[model samples]
Target: MIVVIDTSSLLSLVRYYLPFDKKGVLFEVIKSKVSSGEIILLDAVYEESKFVGQKIILQKLDFLTDKGFLKENKVITKTDELIPLAPTRFLNMVKNQFVANPFQLKKLNESEFEVQKNRFMESADAKLIMYCQHLIKDNPEEEIYLVTEETPSANDLKLFKKIPAICGILGIPVITLPQLLEKYPEVDLGFS
Candidate 1:
């Protein structure tokens, strides 16, 4: 199983678990899985988390990278294979599910649409989706899942695209950090 984690989920894991165990038992389990190539930590998510400037988050991510537990998404350059664009159907879904919502676009002028679109394009969610698509394309036989803290919003007023929703549109399976932990119940934290 190749589980691609997003930034929010990573932060949630760090904030919730690190205080309980300074050695980061849960993180260590995740790290070990990543080292074995069962897990994937996208470079975009890493960069986004580092941008948070939280010492603990930075330290944990640093430890994972330093120990070769985290695998960065393959870099796509112009000379390399051209990066695939998000499917038109997925873009349409984003338009209908997110952008077209009156509440989400409320008080925004026509000119702001471009700004909003640009913001989404540059967002970590967008980057994560791209990486997920790449992984799916490169590894068809592998079961790929996206790990994100984001839940699909019942409220149509959300200004930004949530990770799970985007994953759904892309036909990618999505799970939360807790759900992921449930899969590895045998991992003994030895919590004193």
Candidate 2:
């Protein structure tokens, strides 16, 4: 259960919005995984937390790092520039739809698509995916989990599924933060 967490799950847990528990179940799950030697976090994901300014999330990341639970994989390098190329065929279709008529306007300006693309380009998702892909390339059967809450865009769910699809091909597990809580309720999940 080498779990790779994204910021959304962490934020939700800290805000106590995703789950009804005030015990900070999300934090506990992350910590529990680390304590059990099963969690791995990308360094870029850690860096993303600084933008959040949430003391609790930062503390939890630090705590996990101190315990050697989080791994600094796919660290963002200075030379690594953001390459925001749209999906070849996907982009063409979107463009064609936009050019065709005004009826598809709502679908064109989808927030979900923008969020995912932004996340892929500048956030932890890209780093985590690259790291996981490398891990799979080397050790095909290694188990990894991607912790995130960003639902796939209605139009791009299939593209979003590529994350899990890659994981599935590589025999990894991708679960949301809420799912982790459901599975590991006994773990100490609190942020004080």
Candidate 3:
């Protein structure tokens, strides 16, 4: 039961807005799971946490890194380690293929222009997807749940499917924050 957290869920918990908090009911549940060594976070997840509105999550990175919780494991054990899988290259290949298709690239560019403008363009989405690909590639067995707040539009949906597609190709499971939360309530998830 390796639970990989995304940035948004981490922010919610740190801000005490979501069910998982230092002392929230769900927090207790997740904390136990983490303590028992079930929940884990990817290194990129830390990158996302740095932008959380609250200071608590940002401040705890050092402690969490030291404790081998928020940070990825340096040593590759049979079960644990950061960047545990290697799906990055695979993801890049697919993304490259998508971008190479003039129709798809034009659609993505138009969508980016109409929506994100500058905040989050196709490049950013590609980067995120590439990162996910990296995760799937490196840690083939670990199940990952992307904890993002961004909802997918019809176009975005097609693009986002690359994650699950990659996971499917690699025989890995990819889910969302709430889905993981609901399924793994008994798991612990908090920093000491």
Candidate 4:
């Protein structure tokens, strides 16, 4: 299984699941999986996480990158063959969700919402979806999962389309931190 993790999901793990007593066990396991090429950390996610300035998150990410576990963004050379042109239906859905959602506008204001929506269009979430699609295209037998803490809003006017919603639209498999933990129950964090 190749688990593609995003910044928010990684931060959630660090903040909630990482054991205080056995400091590096969970991180080490993640690092090992990443080093073995079973896990993926996109370059964009790494850059965004660096700016978050959380000591533990930075440390873990640094360890992975330093150990060559972090991967550079995969360039889609045959994008036309692999995916539809820009302003695709998925892209339009993202844009429409942002534009029509009054809650999003109210919270971020029009200007700020536009900025954030643009950022989302270009950054981690979008890249993650593209990468997952590429992986599925190239290796249909391989199990690929996107790990994110983002959830869709029950309210009709959701300000932002979370990763799961986007992934659903793109046909990418998405899981949360708790779901990952539940699926991999053998993973010992030394919590006891």
Candidate 5:
């Protein structure tokens, strides 16, 4: 199984779950998942995370990203090489799916298509969906899940959709952090 994650979900880990454990249970559990290639974060989401937090959140992020950190001599995380941006067949997949799924880019005129494509190329939400689709196409038997802390709101329209809202539209399985932990009950982090 594979999981595609967004910035909000990672932030939720830092701000919500990790706070309950000064001993780094949650961090090690997630790091193990990442090391095992089960959880992949988009490059855009990674870049966004470094700058999108308040001071406390930023400090927590720093701790997560810090190299000199240690608990029982364990590393914080080895996520530096996990970005899927290089040799991104997913980019082509995104373009191909653009005309078909969620937004229906084919329905738009050339000018509008270009505008939408340019905008979506940089959206982490779109990257998450595209990564899911890309993996499904490459490996038919894969059960990929999209993870996000986002919930749908009334303004979650077709063009400007968030991760959870868009994943629903694209028929991808989306789950919250607690739901994900429940799905994999063995990965106990000492909290729901």
Candidate 6:
């Protein structure tokens, strides 16, 4: 199974007050997944984590990032075959979803809409959906799942353009990080 992880899930390791030592355990599990060819980390997601205000989160993430970890782990980036406009095309198709999102993109003017749309265009979320779609087309036999911490929107009033919502529209199977841990029972979080 190729679990294409978003920044939400990765930062979630540090975000949810999982305690310092436990976060390390989870990070190690993530590292094992990456080493075993289970997780596909995107460069865009790593770059997008600039807004993480917590120093501890940054430090832990940096540890995974140091020593060419992503490179050595073969973290996937936007492929050359992945045209720059492809993700934008997707954003355009889902423009209504954004306009409905009162929390984030709803109050924008035309120019502001353009800028916000460009932000989504350049986001890891865009590449993630596109890549999942690409995989579905090119490798239907492969099991593709997205691991994100975002909950699937319960109503249109919420931010319906989040990764989970978009994944739902694109027919990509989605699972939460906790569900992933359940699925992989071998990872023993050794705390008594």
TM-score of every candidate: 0.74, 0.53, 0.49, 0.71, 0.67, 0.75
Query: Which residue segments of model 1 deviate by more than 4 Å?
Result: 22-25, 64-90, 154-158, 190-192
Ten-residue region with minimum lDDT total, candidate 6: 76-85
lDDT of each: 0.66, 0.54, 0.48, 0.67, 0.64, 0.67
Tens-digit lDDT track of model 2 for 1-192 = 466667777777666643445565555555556555565555576667767755557665456445333333322232154232334643443334312233444364678656644544454655665555555556666665677776532345333333444344344467887687666647554533
Ranking the candidates on lDDT from highest down gives 6, 4, 1, 5, 2, 3
| Off by more than 4 A, model 2 | 17-29, 35-37, 53-56, 59-122, 154-173, 188-192
- Error of model 5, residue 3, in angstroms: 0.4
Q: How accurate is candidate 6 locally (lDDT)?
A: 0.67
The model with the greatest lDDT is 6
lDDT of 6 by residue, 1-192 (tens): 778887777777666634544536666776788766688766676666656655445576564556676667665464435533355666666676544465565466778777766666666777777777876677778888888888765554533367777777667899988778777666556643
RMSD of each: 4.2, 7.9, 7.9, 5.2, 6.1, 4.0
Clashes of each: 0, 1, 24, 0, 0, 0
Off by over 4 Å in 5: 55-117, 156-159, 189-192
Name the Cα RMSD for model 4: 5.2
Query: Between 1 and 3, whose lDDT is larger?
Result: 1
- Give the clashing pairs for model 1: none
TM-score, cand. 4 vs. native? 0.71
